[model samples]
Target: MALDETTRQVNKRAVAALEAAVWGLREADVSVIKAVQPLEDLSNVTNAHDPALEELNALTVRIRAAREEVRRRWIAESEGER
Candidate 1:
């Protein structure tokens, strides 16, 4: 997707945090799982302001949702494995 540098960086960091959440789940790291919450919040802020930014914000929201879904699924799978 085409995004300005700021949007791109925000997306990158959000995805990275999401990935970290998944890894944290696997490792049972409370700190990492907690860290994802603020990252999600930052992701929300990154898209806040300006009508044109709405589209980018929406994209960021979708990406964040996807990340949450993956993290949830990872947790579920981990439970199932146990």
Candidate 2:
């Protein structure tokens, strides 16, 4: 293969890997949110909050932010922005 073709193949693989990782992390976050939703609902019923759940919710926000960053970087890189 030509050098440019080889480079493109490598970049494709790298992008695929990055996409898989980012999507997997997002899926895990969804799973965690689903798991904790019941607990949060119970807290609402009792008018109380669980610290661990609160922290997990905060962590979810951070993870979402990270995913957004990753998405932006992915788009930039795909557009040949280095």
Q: Can you write out model 2's per-residue Cα lDDT over 1-56, one digit (the tens) per residue?
A: 69999988877877777687689878978987897788788886775658768878
Model 2 lDDT, residue 60, Cα: 85
lDDT of each: 0.58, 0.79
Worst 10 residues of 1 by lDDT: 47-56
TM-score (C-alpha) between model 2 and the true structure: 0.72
| Stretches > 4 Å off in candidate 1 | 1-52
lDDT top scorer = 2
Model 1 CA lDDT for position 51: 49
TM-score of each: 0.36, 0.72
For candidate 1, the TM-score is: 0.36
Give the backbone clash total of model 1. Answer: 0
User: Per-residue lDDT for 1-82 in model 1, tens only?
Assistant: 5567777576566667656876654454344445555655666777443444444455556656666777875565444431
